[model samples]
Target: MNEQPPGRRLGRGLAALIGDVNSPTPEPANQLAPDRTVPIELVSPNPRNPRRGFDEADLIDLAQSIQKHGVVQPVVVRPSPDQSGRYEIVAGERRWRAAQRAGLAELPVIVRDVDNRTALELAIIENVQRADLNPVEEARGYQQLIDEHGYSQADLGQVIGKSRSHVANTLRLLKLPDVVHDMLVSGTLSAGHARTLVTADNPAEVARRIAEDGLSVRQAEALAQTPAAERPSISRSAPAAKDADVLLLEKKLSDAIGMRVTIALKGNVGELKLVCRSLEPLDELCRRLGQG
Candidate 1:
């Protein structure tokens, strides 16, 4: 028999693995199935789970909902390899956390007999589908899968339902310094801003300036592209003061086009520049201008 390509082999069982985890609405039969309920203490989080940060406020809100209605969806788990009679959570860690907060003694779970690889895949799928993982977390997850399982970026894209470029761009975030990674995790910097800093001479310093000055992704990109020798002066010297009306117009234009806008005035003739971080936004701006 012929061997399947690496990407195809990696992507083979992803659809079935995602199954109900990707579903928005909970199936009635699966919810609170008596046989699926297990003691809360018996279920532990997967250490390899891609999602590291959980918003406390969001968790509190979920806990309140769980208290009112109980857990409507079952978390996915597998029999723990290290501990006998215990289950390791593959998905729904947030739900598990909220259930604990709601003082639940038992949790509904769908137990599957899966190996380490499949467990990680399920965790990533569930989090990515929900947009729960931050860029840093998502990138780290992809890196882990690649390092441990011989997965190519194309394989990851196919498995995660993302474009190959998207996977490649996300993986680029890992090249940033640890301080920059901290910024990303704390929401002090965005994926776009972080991406531009990947090849900068001093990413942490650039990231700090980007955050402190409230620079747009486009501005960050320009700053990252600037030479190290001139960066200090650029950081120190603020933009020329603008009239209130001009600033307001820039903001309006930025909001309207969903990109950064700058206006430079020289007498009656002036320049208005729209800064897009990616081709997609540029295309959208072109479409809008055409319609006008």
Candidate 2:
């Protein structure tokens, strides 16, 4: 058997929490005394969890340790009312899985009383606040807040105690290509590196370069500032603002049409555009032109 290296020795904190390492264990979420212990079966991994998967070798080592030590710590679980006779895991999936691999029939579990949304939000926030979440997971949380619960970016800031800009910035990471996202998750890239990428219309190409160049966050920011004359094909950009005459013509169109009209510049000459939503508005516009 390999001996524990000085730098890799089991920590006192882990020992104290689990009693021994072989047993299924739960890591403490909050400051508490006399940590409650229960079986691994009582807990479940989160469905919309951030962490993709644990390393197999590390897990195998953990399992071997479990065989020798038993779960030193307890796992946290909440009784499932919907699925009677089974409990949903609040946390400690790693220990639970390790115990299973170790062939432990039952692992220590601690029952918790967490509300659903509160539990989900807590799980997400736990990963996020630790900087453990990948960009994809972080974006999913921001989106969940916006789409599922109808919270605005400002509201998300209040809920998570983060700035709205932070929320927006994190959400922007979703725009990155899948390859870049994989890199971010695998620790080959950082979120700050990913942030600069989201602004690019062709983010995949930018992500590739960012990885290839081994660019620092500051360097990435500088790169992001560069004009896109030499980059790969991207969508046509928004048109530049129209000249004064075009703006005046838009105003004139609105006066003649009697509706909210926007005249956006097309090219050098620019162009006038008309918009009328309601039937009444359209009829009035026509009537004003003697074409009713």
Candidate 3:
């Protein structure tokens, strides 16, 4: 007997379940047209899906919540092509399943008249911006954007308010061995730890150390940082300011820019220098300082 891989199986099942991944979107009625509002029936959701388990008891509780508070967020949906009037959920599976469990017949949904490209992009942006989406969901969303929507990391970065390198780095995290990914997704590991592990030939070993050692982000960065064959000793620091005003100004600048600012006093003249971790941070600091 042959068995389909999990990814392949998931894809096949989803394909068979809905005409389009975004088909669950509901269409709004046009006042100009006589024909408006299509009929959609409640259907049993597939249990095998990796999404979530919607409890009936929980649903009753949610129904009470909805009855009291109403639907704060709109459910996402896609139109039905096989049936005359039906829609499937691209996202918000839990809400739909809960609404059904709550004994609600119809859900207020936005029917996005969008193709695959628009659908995946919007879904990714919404999930990423909301900050509710977990790393795995985010990774999946990014993968969908690239595979289905023809988006590069640069495109995704712009869409999600992240730098292109950020997107690329995050995607690379997905390539870590499944064990490492499991640790990442389960919160046993951090993005920084995973990033450092990328340099290791055996990431599993690094992941094991991360789990057992409980490495801090700084510690992980230290391990990841290049080790010099002959380490140089850092010189002792001395305050450059001769007077209180100059020291106060350096501290003030540091606080305002959220970085370390140093004033080196040599005789009558003092050199002001700002140190930052990255270009974006430096640029942002410069912009604020320039404004002041």
Candidate 4:
């Protein structure tokens, strides 16, 4: 009796959509047969690849690895639409670039016949799964799929293995100023810090404070709520004014729990008010506090 081939029955999902050839060692049952190998001169990077920037340091590291180990995983490619006898990368562009840096002459690739939509989806999925996209690039990729392909937020969540709320929140990052987006892309700001700034009245100012003061995400949340005029004054000549650290602490609690939090202290006897925006955030806050 003959045994069935591996990956031949991967029913109707991403693995089937793109060729199941991501593994370092291609199993005879799962690997793309014919084992297409293209010269480095014939392959071009996909213009629509969702990833915008590659860190030079990282590329050097990858190039060094490729030099030592050779490319273990084959890149996914399709015939170039514009040029004859040329291939466009559908996934693994980074590896391809590193191969060039390592002075490689050819690369192994899985040639898949795919249209524009499939190509875009494969690129996005591959980058996201590998955690290669920055927040801005990730949001832009999500927006492209939604706008061009008509994917709903819930549908996108399912595609990317995230929650609907998480998708919604990530989409909100696009509303921030270009500077803030740049900060996120360059790793000057954390995703948590960037998310809290989305709803801020003045995101640029908040971003500046975050970079300058090295404020924690929780502290940034408090800074967003405390009006600009009131913040610096907390340390000034107001004898009756509340302590600055106390205000920051209150804001941290509010941000951490996703609610409106206030603390009023009278000689160490204080009242705490945690205001919930809705039932869901409230439940989340309660759940988080319980975990704490």
Pick the lDDT winner: 1
Model 3 TM-score (2 dp):
0.55
**What's the TM-score of every candidate structure?**
0.74, 0.58, 0.55, 0.72
Candidate 3 residues 261-291, lDDT tens each? 9887877877989765322345456556566
User: Model 3: residues >4 Å from true position, as ranges?
Assistant: 1-64, 224-292
Which order, best to worst by TM-score? 1, 4, 2, 3
What's every prediction's RMSD, in angstroms?
Answer: 9.1, 23.9, 13.4, 13.4
Whole-model alpha-carbon lDDT for candidate 4: 0.76
Which lDDT values do the candidates have, in the order given? 0.80, 0.62, 0.56, 0.76
lDDT of 1 by residue, 82-174 (tens): 999999998779899989999999998878789997788778766876678999999988888889877889888876778999999999998
Worst 10 residues of 2 by lDDT: 5-14
Deviation from native of the Cα of residue 238 in model 4, angstroms: 26
Question: Over the stretch 1-292, how does candidate 4's per-residue lDDT look in tens digits?
Answer: 5522211222134565444433323345654443578898999999999998987866786787778777766788889989999999988898888889999999988787788877887788667756789999989998988898777887777666678998898899999999999899989998889988877889988898887777877788888777777765222223467789989998898778766788888895989987542223454554555667
Q: RMSD (Cα, Å) of candidate 4? A: 13.4
CA error at residue 249 for candidate 3, angstroms: 32
Q: Give candidate 3's error at residue 11 in angstroms.
A: 27
